[model samples]
Target chain A: MEIISFMIAPLAATLILGGILVYFGIHVIKREIVFIDIALAQIAALGGTLAIVLWPETINGGGHEEGHHLIEYLFSLLFTTLAAGLFSLLKSKKIRIPLEALIGISYAVATTAMVIILDKGAGSDVHIHDMLTGAILWVGWDKVLRLAGMVLIVALFHWVFRKNMMNLTDNYDNSSYKSKRKNWWDFLFYFTFGLVIVEAVQVGGILTVFAFLIIPASTTLLFFSTWRARILAGLLLTVILTIPALWVSWTWDLPASPVLILFLGIILIISGLVYQIKKKVT
Target chain B: MNTLLFLGPPIVISVLLSIILGYFGNHILSRGIIFIDIAVAQVAALGTMIGLLVGFGEESLGLEMTSYFFTIVVIGIFALTKFADQKVPQEAYIGIIYCLGLGLALLLAERISGGSNFISKTITGNILWTTWKDVWISLLLFSLIGAIHVFFQKRFQSISLNKSENSSINRTRLYDMLFYMTFGIVIVKAVPIGGIFLIFILLIAPAVSVTLFTNNWRKRLIGSWIIGSTGSVTGILLSYSLNISNGPAIVCLLGSLAVILTLWVILRKRTVSV
Candidate 1:
């Protein structure tokens, strides 16, 4: 009972954060701006790394995990948001960049800065370590709540932009919405998108975040057409897998992120095989 | 004078590698092997992690060091993709290889070196203390590979674009000769610096940027190489001045080039319309 209850909070967090990422992935796949999503996600990791090491530890000089959970979660989100906003500014003309390329460069810069940080007395630092790879098992109440909040915000924003989002994806829709108050809304989409991707990193590290954004949403694109179905498929699949993965992580003493990714892969293979079998049967 | 000598080999290597990667990558992008490059590089990255695991953060493991760590995958990729089974759509197979390989890599990394080390090291690695020889070797391979690509540009272009189903070169089918060689070299070249993450950028980003504006394949090819080289030089300079690591700086610098080019294209299209 206690174990199950322990699991519940993070599960809710996963639902919200995972949903935002799934939506973000779906939208970016449409926009052909995934490379930016990719870069920003890494930058957010960089931001998290900087957040941890830049602060002076109390006694251990680094191993302030359980005590500083609140600080860690809050700072990760804040920095990731900042990184997202900075790159999203590529849409501005005065800044000078094609938004896509700007993102690629930003990814490069962020990752590079991260490399610098890591090299300059960083690898030894647990704060730098934890930020890049999320310490999922140790996720406290604060982290869960944070993820849930982001997820809720994403859900609200997604509900508002449903029509515009659909319109933007389809060519016919894009033509009509071209005149229907675009530029700023586009920023909203991309900005909120950055938040989703970055925050997902906090919950799941870079590898898992990429897999989270990509596999389910992309796989759903295989069969489903409607926005609702796609979101449902992505969310449902994510929940289905996240549970086993996390459970398996605790059981086998494996890392949650990799286990989650493997679940995704296994799900993909099974899904593929199912398709194959159905094709044969039909 | 020493600085030029210091910089000479890596820069030349960079230009050469950029040229090769650009030309071949353009061809591959047209042929739709973009993700394959990424997949293979990631696979190699997984291989390197296996190396790290074997060494256990220690440099040597006597005879057991770095051997067969990637044996399963090296053989798998080599056999499946070495131009033998080119008839069917092997793109899916290649993608599968990448996913599976990375999965194994993560598991191994997690088991041996804790999950955090597994994730961070795989994606954002350190090149802060690279040796001069490392730079020179990168220069050598990048140049050789780049020259080969330039020499075969016309052939690559023919195979890439004029996909007339039954071309004389059997462009799609002729992977036996070229793709594997390029594949092997790409892994070899990409391994030293970017880890698993940056190889795709090295392969695709510049080439894709060039594709945005230029319809003419020649210009597209040339532009990709130029942007890539410029990115490399710029990254090196940034690293020098900012005291940043080389790999991320290069990635960042090239990213800037891509953004700049993309912006110009967007604005140009916008202006021309009015």
Candidate 2:
């Protein structure tokens, strides 16, 4: 009972984020840029690391101090949006390099640069690890409220731009070179997506951000034929699995973030296997 | 003068490694598996992490075996996993493997003492602290791999770059093994000494830069070597004068060069079209 009350804060935040991630996952799966979240998250983390380097007072392993969270948040926002801009610009037809290659390169560069910065600033690897898998157990009401507000803003934006959002992940090779407006839509999508990722990463850590973004949609795609059904399935799966994941963490006193990721991976694999079996049977 | 004397050997070693790696980088880009080096290197790190957990020091034979063991596992999986469905890009699988290796490494890192520092070191390797032994071992291993590439250069290129020409089944399979094995060897050695970032920069940046101007393998190889060597030498000199870490300094130099070359190619193509 004590554990449940303690976990209630993170659990609520997880459910809300999970609901939002279902929408993001639709775009991510259709686009087939599965690692974009990982890339964006790394870029965001680099921003936070830069903040740490610049203002040493904002450092903490479990969580950042409240008053200075804005400093890190602003940096994270700036870095990810810049990355998104570069990525969108790289979409020009004349640039023969594949977007996937650029994304992979961006991930490598952002991560290494973070390490280099952290190393010079007398930061420890634990900070990087924490950044990768955050201390979700330490989440307070204020952090959850902040995350909820970010999700609401993104959700409202997605609602307002439903048509563009629908086409955001359509077959890129066809529509990628069609119009400047289309490119603008892509940039806007990435920019807004980056904002959510920066918050999601801070709240849940990198692995959870990726899992929520990829696993839910990926698992649903295995069973559902349409985007609507897939999103519904993803939402259902998140609600179902996140509870057990939190419970497992509570019961074992293990870190909830990795445990949650482990559950997501297991559920994804199981869904994939079941889908394969169903395909074989039919 | 003393700085010159101290930095010369490592810089020269970096140049030689860069030339060979630049060659491999072109092949890797051609193969469309740009992230394989980092993937294989992470597996090696995972192996090294496990070795440490089990009480084997970094330099111990046990750790060496574990590192090689993990590298071979990844290389085997990557070489053999051929999907019948062509819809899924190979990059997806490479991304998956990389995430798995890194996630497991982070999880393991939590248990090891000073694991974060160790992991960071693995990524941005400390080249300034390298010994002559590190240089010689890299030279020997790279030479062996380079020999395989030189001898079977045509067969390897046909299997990797010109996939349609690889109709001879047995020969194709043989060279495929040779390619992955040699790649595995280079990454295993390069990661520990050059750090993952520097090695990745050396492997991809140079090769990718040359792709902007030419597709001819010979010209690309030579062009990449010149860029990589010059960048490394300059980076080393800067690191010495500025008292910064050699690995990041070199990575920044090479990374900037790659960006510049890519931009130049793009602009030149636009001008030609205009």
Candidate 3:
């Protein structure tokens, strides 16, 4: 049963995450800002790192101190929400510096600040290293359930209003260029985007989230033109990648993040080769 | 007096590195080849990890001699990223190469460490953990970087900046190869100080900070060096005293300085209007 639960843990996380990505990741790719997800994840990491670095201060009368649980989620949510909100608000069309640069800066500041902060404190600690890497062995039933609930809620909302979300990302200029209500729809995408980064960070750090956000979505956009196929492809790819990653990490004693990343890399390379072959043959 | 000496080396190194990287990086950034910086830094870092694993393992010399030797390997691999005129944007190639390089490094490190322990340092980079020996090594690296950058400074400017002059000039494919060689070296040397996380800022930020003030590439380079120099002096102290990460503090300082100057420019604009 313990082994079964352990196996199910990765399966559940992958399915839930893959389903959500299948629905939304395609559009994120279409926007040509796949790096934005990584940026948002880094921002979330920044927030979480800040909170973790400061949590000790709260105990010593620093009001900015946060609970361990809150530290993990709150800061990331704050940054992601604020950033996503701003991106939606501006309806940014072709920012000169890809949003990834902003995210990279966020990581630079957060990771360094975290080191300084952590160095000063001595205590009962959670090494955030594993969380960021998504060592599948680290995922438990609780994490799986929480992420599942979040994904379910997101997927449901996506179902009822898929048209609005698609319109906002696929043709933002058309939407905001002519209609105002569409701006509100963009808000929903940003909200979902922010929420995914926050929740994913608490569960699997940024790398896994970044890889799925870009690779699967881009892969779909490459082969499939319609929104529905792209979403299905993304969902399938995320699962296909995640399962093997978890198994390989366990069997080979490798880190899950790299395993997951390698799986994505393999998929990307294979897909690229196939795409090339098809182009040649046709 | 204490602070000046404390900050002197890193500040100098960062400024020098910034100027050298500026000529290559700015071109890449403008062309939207951002991930290339990350990809290159990561490949070099994996080389460093191999150096660390071998250096610390009974014999240290093997590590030092071999770590940078891997740059040749990365350059050879990265050269293929252009993929014989395949239309994939340079940034896409960068992302692919960076992920592949990092995956290779992570696999190697885990095999040696037997766990994912060193990964924290691998991904984020730990500067406070830097040794004086590394500082000395960085100084030598910067000197070498400085000599090369200044030597061909005009050529870089002419090729990347002066497009109209391209037809008239005869710098040749050798010039392109020289730039890539320097680009690989900058990434290799910048790894320890800037790590994968902050090199992009050091590469692009000071340059970005400088471009706001001047149109001339020389002036832009000088302005960026000044910003880097000032940030280096201040950031190291801030990192030491306030217990902050020096890299981000440097970046924040860079960003803050940019904001102040930007504010001044807006103020000047208003004054002129009135």
Candidate 4:
């Protein structure tokens, strides 16, 4: 009972976060901008680190002081919006470099910049470890409720723009170069994406957020084709995987985020194998 | 003068890393596998973690060999998955591999005492503490890798730049395996000295900046070396004066340089159009 009670918050957090992430993941995978989430997550992290640097009071031992989370969130969101603008702008055909290369460079530069900032300002090496590992297991009910509200708003936003969003991702290769409206839609998509990533990274850390975003979607894609089927199945898969992953992590005293990621990776590999075998059998 | 003497080895190592990584960065950019280095570096770090877990001393030859072995396996996986690019983009796989490696490393880090320190050190590196022995070893290893690249220059160029349809699938796979194998080896060696962040910047920023200006392969390579070396030297000096970590300092310098060059290119194009 105690363990179950303790696990409930994290499990709920995962499901809520996982729901939106998997949806975004499908679009991300479809558009083939697979690394964009990680890049944005790093940029958000850079923002959060800069906040800590500017206001050292935010660094109370390892975690931030109470009520300062909003400031940090806003800082990260501001940085992410700027990056979203840059990404949307850079989608020009004149640029010969692949978008993936630019994304990778963004990730590298953001990470290194964070390192420099952390070194100079707070001098907290522990913050780097914290950012990567996250505090999913220690998540409170307040945070979960807060996350739910944000996810709902974003989910509703996506639902309203479903036609534009779906069309953009579905026919990305065909329509992207033709439409000037594509960039506007891209900015909106990325801004919402940044919102989710900033929150997701806060809860699940970068790796878990990535695993939640990519692995479930990739796994579902191996078994399903349609977006409707893929998103529904991916969300279902994440929900199923989260419970066992949390249980295993709790029972064994393992780190929650990585164990969850490893579980996702295992499921993805199994799904790939099953897909291959089904192809052979049919 | 005293500062120069103290920072000499680090400066040399940084320049050396930039030269090789700059060359490989061109290949990476052309191949559209920019995140491959990060994936490879993460896997190598995981291998090192595993080696440590299995009781290999931190600086032991066995640990080094274990790291190399793990890197080779990832290189092989990447080579095999190259064909799957038709079905799924390679970037997805690279991203997956990176996450898996990082997650597993974190899981393992939880087991070791002071493991978080090790993890942070791998990311930030300890370039200031580098000895002359480290410099000589990297020089010898880098030169050996450089010689191999020079020897097989034509095959690599054909595969990476041209992606010629003339080459057989198996032959291309072999060349790719060979390419990533050398690339992985360089990353493994360089990660210890410059850390993953610095190493990534060293690999990318120079090649990216140079490619902004030139089309010729020789010009790109020479330009990359010049840009890389200058960034490295200036970065080291700045870090020394600022009393900051060398790797991030260098990364910031190179990163700014790349950004400046990119903005210049974009603005120049705009002006020309006007």
Candidate 5:
């Protein structure tokens, strides 16, 4: 009962973030840019590192000064949103560079920059380790409420721009100036996406954020066909995975993020194996 | 001036790694397995980490053996992954393998103190600290792999570039395994010396940069080697001057060059059409 009570806020937040991530995962899978979450999350991390560096006494210091957390959050959001815009622009048909490689490059650079910054003693007094893996097991109700608010705003945006989102993911219609206008919509999509991911990354860490963004949707793709079915299956799996993962983490005293990611992998592999066997038999 | 002397051997090693990686990178690109280098490097790092858990030091023979052992396992699995439906994107499998490898490493790292640092270390390792002995070993291993590749260059090229050739599924799998065998060897050896970031950049950046200029494989190989050498030298000098880590500096520099060349290609094509 104690453990469950403690886990309530974190669990709720993880589920909400997982659902949002799975929503983005659908577009990511369709666009075949699966690793964008990792890249953007790392960029967000870079922003956090920069914030901590610039305001040593404010963010992540012993005392959480008023508005410091917001500044850090905005810094992260700013970097991620800009990266999202750049990624959208790079989707220009004329550029022959594979977007995945570009994303991978950015991820590498961001991670490198992070290590260098951290090495500079910017996070000397703080346990900046959680910036990447995150402290999910330690999230509070206030954080969850804030995430819920962001989730609602993003959900409303998706509902309103549902048609544009679908077309951007599926159509690949990079023909003319009209497509360029559509690109701005895509930028808006990624910008809002960056906003969503920034909060999730703060709560769940990059690993969990990536797992939620990728595994559920990818696994659902193996099982389902339609968008509605995929999202439903993904959310169902996220819930199913989350409850036991939290239980296991609480019981065994393991880190929740890696445990959750490993479970997702196990589910993906099992589903993949089953799908392969079925294909082979039939 | 003293920094130049001390950095000379490592620079040579980096240049050699860049050339060797650039050579094999064409095949990786042609196969569209863009992330295989990192994937393989991660698996190999897991091997090394396992070695550490078993109480072997980083430079221990035991660590090297275990690293090679895990590399072999990952290579075999990656090769067998091809047996799946071709319609199903291979990237899914690769992505899953990468995440699993990383997640498992993190999990294992829990048992060992400061285990998580190994993950970042594998990505951007300390290239400037590599020893002369390791450099020679890398050169020899690369040579052996290069010999095999050179001997079977045509067969490998056909299998990599023209996938839908006259070959049965079994035969194709065999060739891929062979390619991965050599690839595994290169990655396992190079990773310890150059780190994953430097190796990945050398592997893809030069090969990719070459493609912006021409499609001919021979030309691309030569062009890649040249770009790789110059970029590596430039990156090393910058790292030395700026006092940053050698591996990541090279990766960032090369990454910048690849982006520039890509943009130039795009702009030129746009102007041409206009």
Candidate 6:
């Protein structure tokens, strides 16, 4: 019972974060921009690293300072917003380079820039280490509640703009449907995506967040054809995977995020195999 | 004088990377598998981490062979999975492989003490501390790879440029495996010295920049080499003058150049339209 109680917050955190990430994952898969999440996450990390460099006291002393956290959050938000804008702008028809190439370029640059900044900053070793490995096992209720609130707002925003957003993604290749307003909608999609990524990355690190975003969605995609079925199934898959992963991690005293990611990867592979077998038999 | 002595090896190493990776970068961009280098590099790093778990020394030949073995397995998987009928795109598989490799590496890193240092090392390598011997090895290996590519330039280009539709599937698959094997070997060599991010930039940025100007194969390759070498030289000089890490300095310089050139091309289009 005590262990169960300890697992509650993380379970809730994964469910909340996982639900939204799966939805975004559907869009990401549809748009053929599967790698953008990592790119944006790296850009947000760069923002946080820059904050640390400019205001050493923000993260130098090791104690949690509310103002410092806010500064870091705002910096990340600013950078992600700019990236969202840049991404939307680059999607114009005139640009001949593949968007994937640009995304890869951005990811590499943002990551290297963070390394450069951290090399000059104080207490970089700790920050770099922390940036890579998430501390999901130790998350508290307060953080979970905060993330829930943010997820709720973003969820509502997506709900309100569902039709336009879905149309934009569904009709992405239709030249007639593409418009100036579509650019605004694209920016909004990427902006909200960046928002969710920044928060989820801080909680679950890059790999787990990526696992949540892509693995379940891709797995569900193999079995379902409709958005409704896929989203519900993806969320269900997350819930199913999260409980056992968390339980195993707690039992073995292993790191929760990577364990969860491994579980997700395993499930994805199993489903992929099943998918292949079914395809061959049919 | 003192700075030159200290910085010479990394500079030479960067030039060597430019000469080789710039060529591979062209193939990568043309093939449209832009993230494959990073994915393969991450998998190779996982191999090394597994070697560490198995008690191999850091620079041991056993670890190097382990890394090569892992990369070959992954390259084979990539070659086999290039089916045209799969619902999921190849990019999705690339992303999944990248995440899985990284996740497993992190899991293993947790078991080993001082593992975070190793993880960070794979991301941002210790290029400043590179030695003359390392430079020489890179030079020799790069020359060998370059010669092979030069010899079979047409076969490789036919595949990369997607002009091999008449070839048998098995034959094409053979070429695909060959391509990724060489690409994988180059990546495994560069990752420890330049790190994954630097290798990614080196593999993509120069190709993107040069392709913006020309379409001729020879011209594109030469343009990429010139652009790559110049960017590396300037980036190293910038790192020396500004007192920053060597890998990131070069990455930022080349990355910025690619972005700027892209913007220039865009603006030029606008002016022409106006």
Predicted structure with the largest DockQ when compared to the true one: 6
What's the fnat for candidate 5, on a 0 to 1 scale? 0.24
> In terms of DockQ, which candidate is stronger, 3 or 5?
5
Considering summed lDDT, which 10 consecutive residues are worst modelled in model 2 chain A? A171-180
lDDT of 1 by residue, B161-192 (tens): 75444544344545335645555556645544
Question: Residue by residue across B34-108, what tens digits does model 5's lDDT show?
Answer: 788888887888888788998998688888889989988878887987866553456656666677777778778
Report, for every candidate in turn, its global Cα lDDT versus the true structure. Answer: 0.62, 0.76, 0.63, 0.84, 0.79, 0.85
All candidates: TM-score: 0.75, 0.88, 0.80, 0.94, 0.92, 0.95
Per-prediction count of colliding residue pairs? 4, 0, 0, 0, 0, 0
lDDT (10s digit) by residue, model 4, range B117-235 = 88877887878888899999999999999999999999999888875568788988898899899999999988878888888887778888888778788998999899999988998
- Report chain A TM-scores, every model: 0.76, 0.90, 0.80, 0.91, 0.89, 0.93
User: What CA RMSD would you report for each candidate?
Assistant: 5.9, 3.5, 5.0, 2.5, 2.7, 2.1
How would you order the candidates by lDDT, starting with the best? 6, 4, 5, 2, 3, 1
Strongest candidate by lDDT: 6
Kindly list the per-residue Cα lDDT of model 6 for residues B197-226, writing each as its tens digit: 888888899888888877787898888888
Whole-model lDDT, candidate 3? 0.63
* Model 2: per-residue Cα lDDT over B1-274, one tens digit each: 8877787668868887798889888888887677788778888888899889989976889999999988887787677654322333555555556656766777676698887777767766777777777778778877887887889888888766764772565556666877888888888887877888789888888877777678787998999999999988888888788777777778777776666666666667778999
For residue A39, model 2's alpha carbon misses the true position, in angstroms, by 3.5
Off by over 4 Å in 4: A55-67, A120-123, A171-176, B267-274
In model 4 chain B, the worst 10-residue window by lDDT is B83-92
CA lDDT, candidate 2, residue A217 = 71
Each candidate's DockQ: 0.29, 0.33, 0.29, 0.63, 0.44, 0.68
Q: After superposition, how far is residue B151 of candidate 5 from its true place, in Å?
A: 1.6
lDDT of 5 at A236: 92
Q: Which of the two candidates, 4 or 5, achieves a greater lDDT against the reference? A: 4
Instruction: Compute the lDDT for candidate 6.
Output: 0.85
Top candidate, metric TM-score = 6
The runs of at least 3 residues in candidate 5 whose Cα sits more than 4 Å from the true structure, single-residue gaps closed, are A51-64, A117-129, A173-180, B54-58, B271-274
